[model samples]
Target: CAISQEELSHARDSLTSAQSALNNIQQQLSTSVALVDDTVVSSHPDVKAAAAQLRQAFLANARSTLVAPVTGYVAKRSVQLGQRIQPGTATMAVIPLDQLWIDANFKETQLGKMRIGQPVEISSDLYGSDVKYSGTIDSLGAGTGSAFALLPAQNATGNWIKIVQRVP
Candidate 1:
């Protein structure tokens, strides 16, 4: 079926109106982007913070290039003279041999007799038989290990059976 000239004219007018609306929207978006860019240039806290961060970064960069934070014998030197090192990039650890804590994972049952002020004995498997370090129990965990587990038990179901739970 052939369209009348009048219908074709109306269709053209509709298309032109839609195009005009699109153009207006585009102009508004462009203006908004420009405004945001200008704001970033003028009064951005992040930009100001970036300047300070760059100083710290440069200090880190300079340390990586010329000097090091903690100079030792350089036991394990991973990087050569001119290598791009990133932040938190463990070039070498400064093992001061100052102090360290032994992470002892006591069972949930044993924790019942333990208290914050209660004295306790700690033995290391690496040391063997001999008691290495002794310390008081700092605190009990607020929740059990299963609390932070990936798939926590869902007790929301009506068909769920009752079970006694233990917490450290």
Candidate 2:
């Protein structure tokens, strides 16, 4: 009976140690799963970072296809197949002839009576006066062309020259 009691006590001790080990393993597993379960898939930092990388890759792939916003005539195309274009590079030009506006330059004095929406008659040498096109003054020039030139006229110089200014 004494030997049986000793063996029973030893078994109890082994059972307690096993239970403690199992509890520790369960705690570790719960902690690992908590990282992925507490938050939504989209809001999780790891998932969000992965989604952003996928979006960046999608944009990089989409750069190969060029989509123009407006429907118009392609005046010129300078892009070649498999050509690498830098940012802000001129690839092509689209000219919408339907929305064309004529830029007419006139003397500064001539713009005094010119108002917006005023009707004007236009005659081109190529089309002749027989094809007189009716047009309206869209906008008046803010300043003379020389004022916005690459090298503007210096009237403040000691040898200043008075000249008639033309505005467009």
Candidate 3:
């Protein structure tokens, strides 16, 4: 051999180092293969944890969507943006225009001979009185509005006074 003893020794040391690296890699491969089993990928602990996190993310995404029971405009949301509310909280209100009713009050004297299904001409201050809205009288009230007013005049009191009552 033309190589010197020192060079041969150095080459041997390099070869030994390379062999050690290869052995370590091969051992790692064997260990990795042993870790694989008949369990499905989803059944692995790490995969399960990831799947749980994914499910939590999906739930969070679902929570962000406000699905009203009725197909109507969102009248209100009790909670503000990014506000944390407990589950089953009443967070929104919907006013379905399709199912709406107007509570029109009229003087008791005006309801003379009025019956259900009577055509009514309505107007609002929002639009001018010229913009009349035609509607039908659904039903008549049995009592006057003063009877059900929030602050019903204590008529039985000493300061009782005469007041005209309205009806719906």
lDDT of the candidates, in the order given: 0.71, 0.86, 0.83
- lDDT, candidate 2, at 77: 93
User: Model 1, range 1-168, lDDT digits (tens) per residue?
Assistant: 999999999999999999999999999999989878656463678788888898999997776554645434444667766678787776754443334434455567677677877876777788886756766766677776577678978777669675545664
**Residue-by-residue lDDT tens digits, candidate 2, 22-41:** 99999999998987677676
Where model 2 places Cα greater than 4 Å from the true spot, the runs are 1-72, 80-82, 86-89, 154-160
User: Which candidate do you rate higher for TM-score, 2 or 3?
Assistant: 3
TM-scores of all predicted structures: 0.38, 0.48, 0.60
- The alpha-carbon lDDT assigned to residue 151 of candidate 3 equals 94
- List candidate 1 stretches off by more than 4 Å: 1-62, 65-83, 86-97, 153-168
Question: How well does candidate 2 match the true structure in TM-score terms?
Answer: 0.48
| Per-residue lDDT value at 12 in model 2 | 97
| Candidate closest to the true structure, highest TM-score | 3
Candidate 3 lDDT tens digits, 93-146: 888967766887888778886889988787889998889877788888888887
